[model samples]
Target: MAVRVLAAGLAGLVAAAGLAACTPAPSGPPVAVLFPGAADDDWGASAEVLRRELADDGYAVEVRFAGDDIPRQLEQLREVLAAQPAAVVIAPVDATAIAAVLTPDAAGEVSVIAYDELILDTDQVDYFATFDHRAAGRLQAQALVDGLGLADDPDAGPFAVELLAGSGDDRGAQDAFAGAMEVLQPYLDAGRLTVPSGRTDLEQAAILRGSPATAADRVAELLAADVPLAGVLSPSDAMSGAVAEVLAAAGVEVVAPGARWSAAPLPPEGEPSATPTPPGATAPPPDATTPPHTDAAPDSAADAAHDRAAPASVVLTGGGSTLDGVRAVRNGAQTATVYEDPRELARAVASMVREVVEGAAPTVTQGATTDNGVRAVPTLLREPQLVATVEEARRVLG
Candidate 1:
């Protein structure tokens, strides 16, 4: 069962005992897992996996969600630190703000493992475990190139592409943008790809907190201005769904490579899929409407004729293998999404915590370190896979 505590009651919950109820009075010392929020499917899945694995390893596990409130998270962290658990694994809401609460004295004798997001400006973190964000960004860019047939036809005239980067505060987001630009800058220079909106800088393209509505609004503005967009490099699956809907509403076709648009009407947004989502895969967005397929019949003969005269299809790329993303790929709404298994990430963090609790060195790849502005923290990075087809999505997500 998913456990979420209201931000207002967090202090009471911690004072009463800890954030979560332990697993049947386990024998070993207690461990605590802190996540940014319960809303994100990736964090929810990871929290459950961590709870089970840590309990199996003879540790009494307690999990808590901060509900995306930085002040509330700080309060929870302070309270958790007061109890002095054997270890604490955290995926921060605000990476820099959390550093203020995780001083050496505050985290005394407790092993701190940064989960997913790195804790910056503090040397207090013991280890960092996350996916290779730069590589994920590179894969998204490559997907756009492949979907647009740019590799085979380099002379394709001035294809207009818009870049949507992740949140500005996130270090991972910055790295991803940089990596994507490394691959895309050459095309821009050669005039193969053009930014009609001219919002190419990370500052301009960034969607605060990776908000889907913000991304959708920006794309809508671009569309209203009649910017000829051949492709859109979306940052995540949720944002991709939002952007796709805006395009679909404007009668633009969004299709993956080699995928034909389905004529079947799309199920309502956030409707439970007949296909069950596999464990560890991100959940579909609750409020985002699925984009309409290109082959759907128009309401009138005039509308049908207009559809037949529609402009070129747009190639859109996303990451985070959410269920909606898979379905969108199947129905020709999104081009591709990169898959990063959250269960694998949880297992890695659990292993590191166990190592620390058992008084052994945490196993990390040799010389894999992430500089957290203070010192080089030992880091473990997992690779992500790109899925364009439903078969590939099922295989990778499952």
Candidate 2:
């Protein structure tokens, strides 16, 4: 299985050589790995991984972080292009904002791989390599379900859930929430889970650019609204931490005691026609299927809210394999986090780069292509793994 997936991942790189063979040979200049945010914990981790992996493949790689400035990143990118590298891998801060700077005309015809984030409205991108973010959301939902003992005890009262998402501009947030809602919406529909603040839209749940401060502010609003929360759908560890912090400040615990969970299997890929029936759900009748779910959570959720102990944590889930996220899972603050293997991403991107530099026609038959409002960019995607327990998080992340 692993071998097959790896081969599929390299399909685009394999084509690169053939297609670009007519072009002049790529230069001896070092390749550039650009990050939208250099100091960011998650992006930094992936950048480090890329550096090591690409170096091992004999690519002299130079990594640059675009520190919170749009023009700065563009300048840095232009500078890198000035050096005449064979290819460049970029995870842009603003997908649309960076499009003009990356024009092959301006950059002097370098092959560019859109890493992680999709670069939109342009034909400059050669390939898009990222994990199935929607799968990340599904994993988050499943982990939350398991952590709350919903699947373990169907009789367990429906839990109150708060939904949060990544950047609104990001396709990842769209896909993640869409996928999460696919698994969780039924529960919302079936009276198994809910959002107390009634904020279901990805926009309402968004944490700008995965900003912790934005998440904290939203969480504060939820607290001010006096809504009870038993579970939260956090897209990344940073947002999870922010949510956790505000709850702590409000004198609420971050992890419920005596909580136990086992990982649940995910639904099949390619968006299964019919997702597995949410645990404890019943097939609706042909008529009279609507339940007046006026309130977000049921009576039990309110009960849990009213009789909270001095310190009690809520069930939470996130994605990414950043150091903080891994430690949170290990320490039990986060019930689970989906780890989209960065090593695989690096390997595939590196392979794609090498092929492009060799002037090959890289064809990617694997993974889905996302239409970036202009053209469909071929993608290489990997599935993320759920890390629930301290032991599990440590084993995988350490």
Candidate 3:
């Protein structure tokens, strides 16, 4: 799996190099793509896809990376906007800080598309193309419930779980946390789940910048205090890996990734289930018609028996189907990670650019609006998938 991942990355690099080397002078309408950094695998993939797709559509595409420096990103945006390109697609380093330069007048006639991350505090952003973060959070919580067999065995446990939210400054992180809590809260109230650390609030659970060290420290502290956790709701794949490491080092048995565990059958249509619904809300439909679980355990029977006997088989759930995250899932370190396909997002943005450039309204399958502290920017939010098995990871990550 690692070899395959590496090979794919190498192929991408070669393709990018070839594209750069063979580039001709700009003869088509100019389009600028500015990203916070190329360090993130998802972002890098998105940038490459956008460049190729837009160029194929006869646009003069220029892609820039800011190395996660807010000032550098600001400078790049300013420089790009100065050219008065037909369109500018950006994923900001700091959503709030970038608003200073992404004003209506500054962007003039250029249609600004906020990619991946929303650019806040400005009304100039024309469209947003990204994943539905709140839905991702809800999926994470659902994965935990399914992994622990909580839905099927509601009376089996007041299982201890830890909550780890993302950076406070990031709106997507907050939305994810909120969405997860919405699904988990009813379980907590019904005594199906418990938090031993007593840190349930978003503010309390948030790790600044989703720092791995912070997450590791928190997990270590929990272990030191002998908090026997059955699961952890991690905001991202990076933190999930960190938390799993801490658990492993402390002698906790993490649930074997991709192992089959029986999932509770979905309730009949228009019928209520054992789980209680919050007031003024209807229960969410089952996440899948066919859950990720298999009919039989993937490992040996003895190993399955040992897992059942283990006092704490921690089920870890994460977001971002990053290479490291997929590797962890394949190796039985993390149970699952959400797959938000960057290529799909980039294609959406590319299509939007084409429509806007041709003076047509952008067509969105899932249309919504995000208020960027000035006006509600029209947005197209794509749903993400959950990856739990090596085969699933291989199929999606490829």
Candidate 4:
């Protein structure tokens, strides 16, 4: 019965995505990249890197935001393809629905590279550049293992773990869960970790369900649950922040998988200068490693504005330099995060686009395909490093 119910749910989701599943990639510019969300969002930071690098390499790059709307994104892609660029780069907001449209017929005219987020039709996309998200999950689990010293003493029975998945529509979130599970399975098999019911929280769904408060409430509920949790598999630093607030307020020592940027691992950090604010309002205390925030009520645009205006420190993470996610890891803020140098990725894509435009075939390393509704796609996967802590960040940041 349970299996049937799950299948039905999946089918229903697919059914609702009728036109979305079969759409194909359209021909477009030498390099047209779509940003599915706001440019300033952390996830969008990667797009910026790609844009800057591609521009530096003398490529014409057109960037557009999808504004969190799938239909709008599709329309944008159609328009972009009409321009007939050599290739189109995309970070899809909804992989499944977007996959419906990424047909080779749409993409056959151009080379496509699915950035960070994996797009469905593999045959159409010539290259894929992203972090080894699965490995990131393993790193998060490993961090919990080390933090709890599970390896040293195997007798730690039944530590609880909650999975705060990113948007349900995000493939990275799904992959991160898989990666985390790979590391956690051993502990689960040994009865060393216990995942409680209602532990799998999806942020976007919560919003869609009109329960934005559920995120914090759920974390609080989990912490207060009878079973004790050793940690949580948080897909992003933002989620970790919410979980942290609840745990901190409850005086519970909770663990979560956080990204390198939020987990600045250093101490006595070089504090950046703060912009002067109104005399009545005082500056929030600096986290030294994490982004700043204002303690204001929800829906307070003024408060949100205040938080954004604060001068933030530049912590190194998410890219493979010699530095890893050092600051966040040392500060116990992040467990692990993906690091893919967009400079390298952009250069590769630029070259691939050029090849596609010149009617030259792109070289493929490891051939693989992801199923778009109509067909399978040929793909080249890029490797990404998962980093944790100040030392690791320092090692990579260099």
Q: What C-alpha lDDT do the candidate models reach, one value each?
A: 0.79, 0.74, 0.80, 0.56
lDDT tens digits, residue span 1-398, model 3: 99999999999999999987787555778999998667355677779989898888678999999876999999999999998999999998888998889877889999999888899988888888878889999989988888878777756677778899999878889889999988999999998889888889988999999998898898777665555567889979889888888877766667766652422345799975443322222444533543544354425433333223223468888888356777777777788888787788888888899999999999764548887888888889899988877788777656
| C-alpha RMSD by candidate, in order | 13.3, 15.1, 13.8, 19.8
Ranking by TM-score: 3, 1, 2, 4
Candidate 2 local lDDT, 1-398, one digit each (tens): 99989998798777887667744443345789988766456678778877776676566888898867888888988898788777889888788887877776766777888988888988878788888898898988888887778877877646677888888877988999998988888788889887877788887877677898887887777665555566788889888888878877776556532365322344568653322222222333322333543333324443333433221346778787556777787876777788877777777777777777778865454657889878899887777887877778778865
lDDT of 1 by residue, 258-356 (tens): 553222244689974232222122334322242454345545544433333223568888887346676667666788887777888889889999899
TM agreement with the true structure for every prediction: 0.78, 0.73, 0.79, 0.63
Instruction: Mark the regions of model 3 whose C-alpha exceeds 4 Å error after superposition.
Output: 1-26, 39-42, 258-310, 365-367
Candidate 2 least-lDDT 10 residues: 274-283
Report the lDDT tens digits of candidate 4 across residue range 1-398.
Answer: 99999999999988868745564333333578886767776446656777665665556778888877999888888787777677788877766566556665666576677766667734565566555566666666666666555777666544556655554545555666677678777887787776675443344322222232455566566544423444655555545556555656654433323321111123445865444332223445544554455543434444443343211111111222212234445465555545555555555655666666668876444655544544555554556666655566556656
lDDT of 4: 0.56
> Residue 254 in model 2: shift from native, Å?
3.7
Candidate rank order under lDDT: 3, 1, 2, 4
Off by over 4 Å in 1: 1-25, 39-42, 257-310
Residue 259 of model 1 has an lDDT of 56
- Worst 10 contiguous positions by lDDT, candidate 3: 302-311
